[model samples]
Target: MNKSTINLPENTIFEVLVTTTNNQKPHTKPFGMKIQDKQVVLTLFPNKTLNNIKNNKEFLIQFTLNPLIYTKASLNKLTSKDYQNNNILKEATVILRLKVNKIIEQKNNDKYGENIITTIFSTVTDIKQENIQVPAINRATTKIIELLVDYTRYNYMNSNQKTSYINKIIESENIIRKTGNKNHNKSLNLIKKELNIED
Candidate 1:
């Protein structure tokens, strides 16, 4: 088996493309893959990506720091032109092809009240670095994606749980403060306003 070698940050948002059994065009969505040792794991809720992965047994994860892509993807509103230009993969400094290794199911959680979630362990079958230029390390985009994930669960969470996620966003703001550039800061500010979080 080939070993996965990319050292990705824990919370970076990745654009994952999962092919549908009935269609030629692949489904592109934003996801976060956890890297442990030489393996990659994805914790996904019941969604098209999870279901497609179960049937297809393969997926592609792309690493991009573009906040617009993250935002549009989270809303399931990415334009066809975006894919035509290979913008996601091009902007992505690296990409990984993973084959499913294992799937573990987690029971109901009190926090988000999700009935069940699936954790998938996959082996890295291939790795591609689309660009060799200096990659942007700013994490604002990922943090925004994380915040959106939390928002999805907000309806299921209790007051304390919602507060917990809000605090997580606040903590993320510190990292944005450190390495985020003007675009990152602009994105963060917009998200903060949308969330009605006062500084």
Candidate 2:
């Protein structure tokens, strides 16, 4: 199958789980990437995902609705069962194997500050189709993703950054209470406890 088979909204960045292996060891991380010109594109700061992709120019992109998987991935707690053949996330509804086409280096400035981000431009080399059940969009899931992103950097954030980050997390918690499933709330609770945020 081709890019058209994947069928995600164009130009809009979305959350995905990535699997990369180095020396036959698997690593998975939650990240956001957008499709532009049928290419998979994402920028990363220095991290395990970036290192693995730099050493190995291939990785698996997973689309899943399991917030538990996102929680485990964010907390570095994914065990062997979370993966199938060392490359596929078990919860993935759709999978894409991409080959790096180009890498662009650029400096970016955001609320977090300034840093260099390495952008991966990739071509879809293969596709894995599952029983396609497109999930209904929910505000909780999107906010949860953002909260997790800020959670990763929470320790390094200044007072203002930390406040903003925590505020967002609280907002996500509210939405999760109304709209998220048990798994989603579990994920948020895990993050909250890890951050030592009082109820």
Report RMSD (Å) for each prediction in the order shown: 5.0, 2.2
Report residue 46 deviation for candidate 1 (angstroms): 0.9
Instruction: Summarize candidate 1's per-residue lDDT along 86-108 as a digit string, tens digits.
Output: 22344555667788999999886
**Residue 54, candidate 1: alpha-carbon lDDT:** 87
- Candidate 1, residue 74: the lDDT equals 55
Which one is best on lDDT? Answer: 2
After superposition, which runs of candidate 1 have C-alpha atoms over 4 Å from their true positions? Answer: 1-4, 7-22, 84-88, 155-199
Clashing residue pairs found in predicted model 1: none
Listed per model in order, the count of residue pairs whose N, CA or C atoms clash below 3 Å is 0, 0
Model 1 poorest ten-residue lDDT run: 13-22
Measured with C-alpha atoms, the lDDT of residue 55 in candidate 2 is 90
Q: List the residue pairs that clash in candidate 2.
A: none
